[model samples]
Target chain A: MRNFFVLAFVALTALALPSVAMAQSAATSAASDGNTSGVITVIQVDSETNLVGFVLSTQNGELVEVSVNDSTSFGLENAAGDRWVSDFGEDPTEALLRITDQRERFAPVTVTVADGVASAVVDREQGDLERNLGFLFAIYIVTWAGFFAYIFIVSRRQSDLAREIKALTSQVG
Target chain B: MAALPKIRLIWLGFTAALMALTLWMVFLWVPTEINQGNIQRALYFHVPVAWTAMVAIVLIAVASVAYLKTRDEKWDRLAVAGAETGVIFAALMLITGMVWAKPVWGVWWTGEAKLTTTLILFFIYVAYLMFRAYFPPGEQRRRLAAIIGLIGAIDTPIIYYGAQLWERAHPSAVVGPYSNNDSSVDGPVGLTLLVATIAFSVLFVYVASERYRLRKQEDEVMALRRAISLQALRVATTSDSTESISSAPAGGA
Candidate 1:
């Protein structure tokens, strides 16, 4: 029964991780692609003196303001998972509205800013996770947990054997 | 026998303290790798467990050979203990490796040579333990187990030299004689791994020795049971003969 529990634990952990692994690959690929990732916390856009408020994924979550022209473009992902740039005619008001629109307010976005002008912007639904600290912790937890659980099981077996030895020695005496 | 328990307790205490230090160094002291980032930190724990698992296999082979030569139950007991411990460590090694692989290699498992060998090693350990469990207690069981152990030792070297020979997904030896510049670790990174290895070694010894003690007790139990049963048989035979003598015609009366 104890063996069953250990095996079950191992199986569950294995089954649970594939989904996370898939997400990790996506997040890591995005991070390696060399784009800044964070949520577009706030944005103010107009034909004159366009300014967009953004927060970077770094621990500080610093808010950054980027200036863009009416001609500045936005990159958006379609249902087929292909990213396309938004250059919808003169005013980029509709594109700015698309950036601001999201199911989650802090939905991750990748942006390229050069000299305070927005070069490109892409919404990242999965977030960037290049550092991937979660996997590190998972490994540690599994490693130590396995050790501790084995130790407990071994101690219990040892106790039972000790009891048997005592009984057998008395019988022999 | 009295000293053994005290020694094991000491080793356990030492291992626990060293493990605490290892955790600190791994999580906070060492700088992150430029390439693998925080995920690379897994090496501190993963490599040490791998080393422990390999050590257990080698110990088993040596003990098995000793048992074959001297016929000492002590050696056989140690071999059994080592096999059991090796299975646990090997299982942990594989699990931790998988966890490390997902982020770094972008897959949970692959058929790389090093990994494949390690998996085989785990299975070999399991088989050894199972054989010991199911096989009847006697010289035959010990002899067969020793042979299985010696044969399994062949896989150990293959696992050690796997990366060097296959040049596959696994990075080559980083600290051994075969290590090269391409995969070498230095400074705090190397030091942390060294410390972790030592800590795990101490822990492995403690557990394996405790297991060895248990095995010794089990053997004692089996021997006592056999002796008692033999004595009872002899007594029964003697009583039966005496009764037959008493029941006879009393020397032609």
Candidate 2:
């Protein structure tokens, strides 16, 4: 029995290893693209100048300073390459200020840099940390609730089984 | 039989202590991730459930194969329990994953290879459970379920490597042989992950064993019921024969 489990483990591990190279290549492609995908570390809007400045932590871990002007368009995109216009208005400074006001710092945003300037800043869905934390809390509650529910079900079934056994024993006696 | 009393208490205490400590480490000991912050803390439990699901399904497949070879009811019981517990864990895994994805990936779900394949795996085990219950307990039921268990096991590797095999929104493995050094999330995060994994793994064992014992008791009850019905039939047959013999005219005449 022990050997059987060991064999199964080894077989499963062996099958999974072949895909490592493929994953490595994909990661390489995704990580090297700092111009487009990165986490927003800081968003600063200069009300006096109507300009925006933000720090982006690229997938490769390099932090880049991005400057945005009124021309930059805001939008959202997902994994399927599907994208849409953002709720934020066209003004880059206003959008940055709104994002700051909403406290959505450290969320991923798609930035299109052209000639060392941010041409587009897209909010990828609800990137607000507080909103995401609600989902996190929901996840935890659902998980623990599901677990306890399962235990309750098993306990109930056990009770039913015990009762049936008792009735059977009595019948036999 | 239920878990031995002494061992059961020890396991309960240990599991509770480990779980409490993991919760402490997750909320207090570990600092919020500089990048993802508090939402990222979900990883401590999410990753461990995923790992336990993988391990449980693997055991189910192996037990199924052993049952096929040996024809032992014990193996069948083990497989059933493993698969049942596996389904619960996989279900939790998918739920937590989707919750995590919404925050990090900016959507509730993605057709990203890893997420999709894991969903597929979850459904397969669920189907396995339904298939087993649909049939009466017998050779046919066991054999069919064993076959499904083996097939379901094949999905484990596919799910594990899906993210690696395709470029998707799902992040690459943080801690494993396949993890790119740059991709791994560690430090306090890593420590919490370790503690959570150990705690969940123990919980899996405890639950699986309880499920196994329940299955065994159920089988025994079923067998006893069958025996009683057969014996009652025999007694009724004997009594009817005696009544007819006694009611007939004297045999000597």
- Model 1, runs deviating above 4 Å: A1-131, B158-184, B247-253
Residue B17 lDDT in model 1? Answer: 83
Full-model lDDT, candidate 1: 0.69
TM-score, chain A, candidate 1: 0.42
Interface RMSD of 1: 11.1
Per-residue lDDT of candidate 2, residues A31-113 (tens digit): 22223556777766665745466787766798888886655555454344454433233444446554453235455765657
Overall lDDT per candidate, in order of appearance: 0.69, 0.69
Clashing pairs in 1: none
Tens digits of lDDT, candidate 1, A71-98: 4555555445444444434445556556
Query: What TM-score do all the candidates reach, one by one?
Result: 0.67, 0.71
Q: Please count the clashing residue pairs in each candidate, in the order shown.
A: 0, 1
Return the TM-scores of chain A for each candidate in numbered order.
0.42, 0.42
lDDT, candidate 2, B1-253, per-residue tens = 4567578668857886897688667766666553444666678878899889889878998999999999999999999999999889988888998888665654566555655666788789889999887888898899899999998787667665765566455443221111121235677778889999999999898888878878987997998899799889999999999987987756645
lDDT of 2 at B229: 97
